[model samples]
Target: MERPRRGWEIPGDHVVCMYKIIVTPNASVRGVASKVIRYASIGEKEARQKQEYERFNAEIISWYETSKRVGLVMISYPPEMFDAKYGGIASLLSVIAGWNVSMNEILRVKLLDVFLPEKITKEFEGPRWSPDKIRRKLRTGGEQNCFLRVPIYPRLAYPEDYEHRIKCLLKKAPEIAPDIIADSELLFNHEFCSIDKRIDIMSKFNKHVESMMDAKERVETKTGCKTLFFINVSGKPSYTLEKTEAVKEAGLDGITLNVLTTGFSLLEDLRSKFKNLIIYARANAHALLTRGNSVGISFDVLAKLFKIAGADIIYTGAPCGSLDRVKPLDDHVADIRHRNTIVRNPIYNIEPALPSISGGVHLGNLQVNILLAGVPLQITVGDGIYNFPWARNNLDRIADVIRLFKKAIYIITQRKENMWDDHEFRELRHKKCRTYFMEEGKCVDPTDKEIKDVLRRWVYPEFRDVLEKWERGK
Candidate 1:
């Protein structure tokens, strides 16, 4: 009769949102119990009564201190606090990232993970094109046939330069065809080379590549697969929408979005607008949000969010690449595995996103990447392909590098031989040539002793033949 005490009113059958957060207690705060405070609106008497009716109040599900300063807590909130359907990702972050008034006492907060209920997970139309569907469409058969992606880089000042590169790459498409060719994130719309001009050039080459593949299909079973060309479409909402419309009209394969730069909501809107176009989410600026230990969200958590936002391919940094310089070997590997697992694992009705291992992948380290990330993955090489000494002087050699990359993947995945014990393989392994990228220290030459060592090892006997034939320019 008191009008439910203004803001303290409780509704029947209210859904609860669950979250796992890591918090660093302020110097004044004492004990773990002090870290787990309930929402101010939820009175003890009302909470107890709601529990009896199968409805729950905002409360700490679990809590434990990992260190003197840091503590891990699992908390639940009433529907009044957050609603996935109406709130979306922004509101979800506001709650877990400690923007709530109840979290004012905490010094530092890091969102480790979130366990959303089915009702919530279903609201997000996860990835429209699952990794398996992508593979099938690309004609990439078998688990061993990993998807390869290369980028157009070094900054094209003019549209003609961009067209020239595409022509060169497509001319050698039959020799070593890659699954995807994307524009760099830095390569955005400009007066000198606008998105429309780039899309026009790519659309023209797309037809040529398709024809080349069609001709090769007569002899090679999987050789005729259509290569997806993804243009960088990250910009202002209106501009991005405009560029995407052009890409769709041009019938281009896909478009890339810098998720961290453009925001998750943009990715979701694009997926909703374009049902079939592949969305490659690039989190190049993730380190600013995920590099800290006691602050910011974890990479795994961000990766899951990207998947939920309908990213068909998410860039999970490669363990053997530049990520090793920033993150520990173990952490990098764990991040890669976690991203790979969540995208493919069944969750409500969400489709799986393809985990991309990029950031310095080359033929030298290609085998280690395949070993680390496993099957149904995308390996993207930018500097690895474009910076190759041979390819720098001659565009034809770009196809040769791709051929070597394909052979390396095949040998790693299909061959059953134990090359680790062979003397030449062991020497090559010791040189770290099979792990480090070109820019990390030294550039790997086809004539390098380490490469010759791999050949001499004859570990995957068939690889030796491929290398010899490639050397002969056959």
Candidate 2:
């Protein structure tokens, strides 16, 4: 296995200077990366020279030149820019990115990584519940806590859907208890779900949460293990505050906030405002892309930001998952989990945040993900467990999958070397049926034909017409 490594070269002066630069839409007189600095300074003469000569030099951020249009330039900032007394993650970022956003029409700044001084880390609280506390609280399958998340597409869906989903989970709660059962971001409160302009948003939301709470009680009664249910509460500050209050009032365990959508600053606010509720920060490619052209956040930088903002758990890319272009996935996971690894800044002792492996995770790739991301994990699988070929059988099949998943995880975690030689491991093949297309050891991107085939196979005779209509429209 290749270990993660970093290389830094500083001149004799020991000045912290050099920023990796990339150009966006607007082009300066020359195709050089210095133009990015021009845009980053937003054409401020004094600032540009300081950024170029005094503060730092330029180096390209990317490893390769994918395009002549983009240049990765490194820049170093002055020490005086950091104010120790009023130090914060947001303030530090503002120093780096303040003028850049307004610099050019499409000039964007994505932080590949940041060096957090002790002064900065001490500014905000880290995770309240570390991995140990979380496992202790949830009472997982064995020594390790396996995570499960069920995605609910609609609150207004038919009763049987919830029954089959929640009730089935309730039945399996006792024997195959997972540490966390989170709501997918898909099931968030949206304007479309509201009934009328006159209707109070929280009133409708409270009604929906009531059903979830009732279901949670039933599961806890059977399981004895207190399984936490996190509802995806993401929106504007006003809407988010109202829903968060409603979630707390309803006696729910926690709420999931889409950090990229709500912004990192909002996460800090929620962390301060609601001390009791467990805040889980979530983000996907789609959500992050919507953050605006000026703002670009890399995987590791995003992790540190969440930690600084006080998120208990943050989702990371799976080594072999649906999301693409996330190379060095193992390194990204480490960036979140390992303390004092981001940089050797003397000021603050930054703690580790729980790294969550989600997206296209299943029984097939459980051990593989563990090996890549490292153990003491929060693995959230959706279709891998729920959409299993034989999962419909409430009593036996779901338990079987859970047991096998735990078994594989246990072996790999206990014997790290076993990951290399699968000959020692069992369960080489899957017993369940699946409608979606997938590939081994990589994320599945099913072709159009494969999707159509799955739809035809799974859809009932009555629903075939609707499926065909949708397909035709596509």
Candidate 3:
């Protein structure tokens, strides 16, 4: 008797009715354990099951020729498997990376990427605020097209202290005005500094900054740019919604969510509800899934998913500085490129999200970061700004460090010639390269002579030639 046909075998014009996944199959075996049957009459049932498995293996599994066991495979699933309407990112994730159940046949698998049809793409609202719109809204112009963001950790005494800290930074060097000031992911709703208090303090501070900029009288206030405050709204669904409501009510600029922890569904919900608020999606926790060589999902896939879930800005790990210790520079660069492509590339008519580089980024390697990105970026500094060598002695010098970064970025971006060869670039680097030395952990302030020695011995030698090569190619 003829065996029952598999989905792929019985398919006719299933292009729109299918979603595809590329996975590296480390092991492929029968999902069900074989059982010994006592009766000979039941042999036909087992024979039919065996035939079904063979048909699936032959027709559906498109394996790539490789030396490894089982090899890589591309699997396609019928649209019926997904609930495109009711089921959101969770369901899509299950369809793509749920190897434990739906993909149980593959004992070990690494999900590389996923391609959803237009029908699936149309179901979700992508980023409401594209990077271009954000730039226009902030009235960012000239050589300073890329955004400078500073993150405030939760070491402050109270929510008001956070406001005071930001005010102090801007007051010291108004030119150091960042486009976006965000609360660290570690800053949650503590008893002393609740989300409400933080929002109230920051919203008022934002207004004050706007007023100062509008007046354009005080040289200390003449930043010629607007600052946006993005509070961390990552929490349970109910708490997130409540905090989002407070943010909107207080007329705050934006909210950030740890997408990996809170899940992508919350991101979509926030986008749908608060169409105007900029949603920054943090995927720092993704290292658990993406760090492996031959398991879990790829950063490329996660980047795409973040964009699809309506994140205006996504924090992709930095390619240079501190994160290098965790992974090779090449790997980090590859991940950043993937994220940049996903955010910048026009696909399915969805608005693009802004790719942000954060960990261990500073003025020294800032030019290198921009060159590698080859696109507009949100260059975020944490300890890079807060713990600068000059700032260690006097917090006011933090502004000077920011000013130095602005000068360097302007020279690098605006100049037509190679930045590395430019006199101004070299001068700026020599004067301020020491700022990059003060990262998250290493807080010890080095002497100016020590700084010069370190730069000459390590930083300049390591990055100079590389930056020159990159600049020439660009």
The models' CA-based lDDT, in order, is 0.65, 0.51, 0.63
- Model 1 residue runs over 4 Å out of place are 1-56, 78-81, 101-104, 141-144, 214-224, 415-474
- Using alpha carbons, what is the TM-score of model 1? 0.79
TM-score of 2: 0.65
Among all candidates shown, the one with the greatest TM-score = 1
What is the clash count for each candidate, in the order shown? Answer: 0, 21, 0
Worst 10 residues of 3 by lDDT: 32-41
- Who is ahead in TM-score, 1 or 3? 1
TM-score of each: 0.79, 0.65, 0.77
Report the C-alpha lDDT of model 3 over 412-442, residue by residue, as the tens digit.
Answer: 5555334445565455445554344444333
Tens digit of lDDT per residue, candidate 2, span 48-151? 45644444332233233335444344444444555433455556676565555344533444544454544445667666666666665564434553355445
Candidate order (TM-score): 1, 3, 2
Q: In model 1, what are the clashing residue pairs, if there are any?
A: none
> Largest lDDT belongs to which candidate?
1
Candidate 3 Cα lDDT to native: 0.63
lDDT of 2 at 296: 60
Angstrom error of the Cα, residue 438, model 1: value is: 10
